[model samples]
Target: MLSITGAVANSNGQKVFKTLKNEELHCSEAEMKAHLANLYEQQKGKCAITGIAMHLHGQDDCDSDMLVSPDRIDSYGHYSIGNVQFVCRFVNFWKMAQDNNRFAELLDRVVANRVADTV
Candidate 1:
């Protein structure tokens, strides 16, 4: 015999679940929602590294780089409540590209590059 169950999801919850699954993360939909709410309270939508406000898909203009996303405090760590927080997608990708601790130096270089591009 087989048993089937149904889960009800609002659009936001569905979005969270999809993101987690796509990232191959271990968080449940409920956990992801709770963590995101807490992060919004604590960070007020600012990227932890760049201090710029994140743009969420439904709420703001959806720039892939500026979109809000979960970032693990430790690169290899699991996505537990204390280990994860929301950040700008750009910062998350930039941090993942190299070492997390070098964000300051990388930000400096990024600024210089922007300045050079305009010259």
Candidate 2:
């Protein structure tokens, strides 16, 4: 989990440095790791988007959907302290570059439709 945070922070730092010429806008790896750990506890180890239980990377026999990933709450924003959340890996992929609230609404609709169809 710590390593994942480090990788994400490093990657985002590079992007922010290159684009805005200000790496300080992004959270440091240590800060991100601590934040994620707090979020994990607060979220009850569930994905922020799907409410599904999440597994740390390399946990035994977990699928991609169960993996925890750091997602930017605002797609256009920097990876700062208040801007990031822990979500399922699949949800993060599905939400790429989309407005976060819009994507959540779309996901809700999809689940609603699926439930309706089942009924």
Candidate 3:
């Protein structure tokens, strides 16, 4: 049986375990952390979709929108190394709540609205 106490002891470990449980995916804590680190390097501490600065627990001001969470680029994909990326918690939740094409369209609309306001 999985140990909840140990899983919740570390923030990253907790996230890793939760993802495994919620998604019915399987991966080691070390592997998940490594994947998260890789995505952090690739994204340079920004949301994968929004490109906004991330709010890490110890590194930045905490915000609901900036909470980092693992995302599967292909929703049906396994929680493997290359398939996972880190995204803002809110953005990930929003994306999962809609169809991918619709989500993309809405994101484009939001970006366009922001750009229009700047003009």
Candidate 4:
């Protein structure tokens, strides 16, 4: 959560919180931490997009793909409670700056094609 908060901090060192509608919101580190914990539980330790189980950072067997990452549902939006979701690190990287629904559709197609090819 610290990393995420730091990433969204403005030049003045204040966290820049914005909704998808471009409305400004205020979020402190403590708020972010709590929000993230809630999201982790709400998501059942799975990636929102891929539904794959996620592992905490620095776990003994955690790989990049299995690591949990905080993702903004709308890439254009800043980090806010409503806009953030937990996802696999690889999924987050693959979905960067794309609309969530569109990315999911694309991912589904890719998976289907891969399955067909393998079969």
Residues 60-95, model 3: lDDT tens digits: 468977888878877776787776777788889889
Q: Assess candidate 3 and give its lDDT.
A: 0.76
Q: Candidate 1 versus the native: TM-score?
A: 0.61
Which digits, one per residue and each the tens of the lDDT, describe model 2 over residues 1-119? Answer: 99999887778544353454223448679988898789889999898877889988778878977788888787777889898888889889899878877898999999899999999
Q: Whole-model Cα lDDT per candidate?
A: 0.74, 0.83, 0.76, 0.87
Which candidate's TM-score is highest? Answer: 4
**4-110 per-residue lDDT for model 4 (tens digits):** 78766745766667755454445987898999999999999999998999998778988877799988888888788889999999988889789999999999899
Which stretches of candidate 4 lie above 4 Å from their native place? 1-25
Clashing residue pairs in candidate 1 are none
Rank ordering of all candidates by lDDT, starting from the highest: 4, 2, 3, 1
Query: In lDDT terms, how accurate is model 2?
Result: 0.83
Least well predicted 10-residue stretch by lDDT in candidate 1:
1-10
**Model 3 misplaced stretches (Cα beyond 4 Å):** 1-22, 97-102, 114-119
Error of 4 at 70 (Å): 0.6
Clashing pairs in 4: none
lDDT for model 1 comes to 0.74
- Give the top-scoring candidate (lDDT): 4
TM-score (all chains, Cα) for each model = 0.61, 0.72, 0.64, 0.75
Q: Please report the TM-score between candidate 4 and the true structure.
A: 0.75
